[model samples]
Target: MTSSDTYQGLAVTTPVSLMFGRFSDAATPLLYARTLKELLAQSGLQKDDVDGLAVSSFSLDPDPAIALSRSLGLSLRWFQDVNLGGASGGIALNRAARAVAAGDADIVACIAADNNLETGFQDLVRDFSVASRDGVYPYGAGGPTSVFALLTKQYMQETGATREDFAALCAGQRENAKTVPHAVFNEPLSPEEYLASRMIAEPLCLYDCVMPVSGAEAFLVMSEERAQALGLSYARVLSSIEAHNTHGDEASPLSGGWATGRDRLFANAGLGPDDIDIIQTYDDYPAVSILQLEELGFLPSGKGASQLATSTHWQQKHNTSGGQLSCGQAGAAGGYLGLVEAIRQLTGQAGAWQRANVRHALVSGYGMVVYDRCLATCATILAAQESL
Candidate 1:
């Protein structure tokens, strides 16, 4: 990992993502500036050192890249505004990483954020569907909550997956969330609790869905050479894949774009399922995780729940940051946030939730398809410095 500056070392000097940064009480101009300033100061990088920007968020509008650059006095060499839904952060990092590695840009900044707590449900519905074309929204699809519910219903019939099984899946996530400090729903919950929660949509109780959480998670990424020059602990960006399920609802029904994409991503990384020590599966709905795991060869098809119910393999604690259900799904940045966690786990910096000797990790991203579904899945293989 530390041979020379001329080589692409296995260590990361620039960030792929930030973890457990925060949920601001409010998104004031001061608060926004403070968040950026804090991260820059935290990393000890000066304003001029920042030369590029990319961002993904649902609530972070009003030209985030420009405003953030202006706030930090950064002269951005390249900038990107990502709107890939749950796949946003992942896409952004992949973009920035490739850009930096190719010498197209250096000192790239990737940010994902949200400022919703007590955010109106109606507003969320309207805003979420905006990603869809007008023709697609009129079906009253609502959001992923409703979309996943229908999928869960169909899945329940196919696998004889009782509502209890789904509850258990989410309940495990909630329990894992208990260990993640920044997870929005960090409180402990039992299966009874998940089942008892009000139904936002059939087969999807309130607990199964992601909530609006406010926080800005930002990463300062520089080329591997610059990172060595600065002396930062980092992981290597091994490989990545992004797949879009352009067929909308029907696509999710037939395939795990998320799951299938993971298969291809790992193949590209030339590592198989066991090679991944820890994982962060985008769980917009719990079934997505089950379906994706099966597709990625981590679990057999139609037996994901059975495997999850009995597996020792994942006992190392996947998504200890509570996945999306616990981790605030910053819509656009949700995917990247998962990628950031892979980085943290690899670097052994994930506090309280740290696992033993995490080297390689898997992270997945799901994007909006339509009618309350996101079959678009992407994955990345990340390795700790030593592993690389």
Candidate 2:
């Protein structure tokens, strides 16, 4: 079905980022608490003011939203525990926006945080799902590297994209990372350096894989009237769409649900790709980002590499926060990174990397790799209030 302006009168504000590191001694709960504290502080809201909370995390197993609410001392009228991995941020925004718009909650806080323990990543992936435990682990393919490697290989064969193409993407993001104070890998990366980087899986090198880090990202969703009464800087949610298990039958999937909902996404937003001033994609890997760029109508299918050279340029219009590629994937926080960055840009909070007159922004998410391919894909368009 097509969509209309379902997200009218919503204000997404108070983007907060915290505790980015290769490892954090703190537990997942502490990370979540710290993030929540900052989210409230930045929004000038008391703890009790937030009656709605949505959380996403891979390490917060056993302790779900109910347990977290008790720990945070929150008596909420609305709550959600998102499990969509990299797509959690957009999904959280989608749900929380509707909640506030429908008066189910006055102000909803969307938060994703994770701790980067010594063996956190490996442990999390070793038994990620039934497909991973049975189909993948038995054959020693315990993590996403092998799966992405296979997809990268197929994507290359189909699109005629080379390592140099992916290198351009990575190299450009490293440049973008320089402007982000919290980014982990801001070191300069040349295409040659990317090509020379050690190969982790066939066709997928060390540089192509995301570095697991500890971090949290959060934002508040409420009505425009509420945001104005608080005198807060906010962005209007123009449109958003999410889907899962698209192209599930393909032996080697190259795309996801983004394409199926692309037309409706733009139509609902009342804008096209050309109207976007900034783009933040879930860059767990360059190739994955490329596919999103293609499927979302930024570039044509099998032609993503062509845009990498220009899109990844310093201070250019793509993955402006350096993405999870250079920013370091902070568990489920990787999903929220783009959303936070987009909100920051729209609110004039992005310091060095802020683009001029960033009236429109696009954020896309892809994640939940089960066995063969990732199942979830989501995208959202946000507009500066003045642009409305």
Candidate 3:
């Protein structure tokens, strides 16, 4: 089936729960359990009501999605284990929505979690991919930071982007972080401070890297009828698209696969970029987020840097949760951060940092950095319940 043809009438509604902050005692399964408990409490859903399960985690090794059902004592009729990293949330939602639409499951609980032990991150980066283990790590590439620094340098040279341009975006996100109680970086930040921060990798400073933390995020997917019956407010998925390995052959990649299906994505949603009230892009690095904006039709390709530098549009409506930059990247849960935040803003649950009239939101994910660039790309447009 085509990407747009997978789930025509399914909607993600109700009871989105997120648990942030660094957890020293939590394991992967425990995080999943806590999130599920909160989700059930928020939605008033009994354990038996969840017939489908979708999970994404970096530390759930040895145990998979099916294992979680047993550990959580859930009798699921459908299950999925999403390992797409940053793209896992979008992919899990797409799959769970399709299952609900197909009558294979009544309600699907999608979750992502991980524990950040002392050596967990290092171990993950080392084994992220064959290319990294055999090629990049041997030279002390310093994991994702090094890989993205090269891309940032090339992006700057190609677009004439100055350090100030990147710093401005970071500073704006920090400002947004001040309102998010769970954000790890809540202190006031200025472009001057961003420019002066210690550089981890050339062109990528400490602010540019996502801090590793242990946490989980979860949301539920069901039919619109079910959500209404439960008297729950939900976000409707107007359109979604996923692509992988689009530019695998391109050396030193500049764009992701979002460009491949952007036209169809907006067409399927019957909405354009201008209609979106807010945007959330996978922000392992600011450069990647800018690339997503360009490739997803918000800005002209290769022009994101200049537009971001001159425009204040993003400062007000983009990544309102301060994104992973301020919240800390919680393993696979990083992928779900934007999705959960979008749901909160749309459902009137984003108390302090909520947008005024968030009728529609654009959320994008890019992940699975192999050798040169991220191989997976996914995006979804969500509409408020009132709009539906």
Candidate 3 lDDT by residue in tens digits, 191-226: 888899999999999888888788877899998888
Which pairs clash in model 2?
A: none
Q: Rate the local accuracy (lDDT) of all candidates.
A: 0.66, 0.86, 0.85
Candidate with best TM-score: 2
Over 1-388, each residue of candidate 1 has an lDDT whose tens digit, in order, gives: 2112222543343333233333444553343465566657656778677677776665555555457567656677788877676777667767777667667677776777655546433455655555553644455655556567778888777876676766767767777767776677778777788878898888788877776555655566666566667777777767777787644546347365655455557666668888888888777777777876777778778877766755445634567567777776653536566777777787777778787888788777777654446645677677787774
Write down the TM-score of every candidate: 0.86, 0.97, 0.96
Per-residue error for 307 in candidate 2, Å, reads 2.9
Model 1: how large is the Cα RMSD against the reference?
3.9
Better of 1 and 2 by TM-score: 2
lDDT (Cα) of model 2: 0.86
TM-score-based ranking: 2, 3, 1
Top lDDT hit: 2
Candidate 1 vs candidate 3, lDDT winner: 3
Clashing pairs in 3: none
**Candidate 2 lDDT over residue span 198-301, tens digit each:** 99887989999998899998999999998999999999998899999978887668877799999989988889998999999988877898888899988888
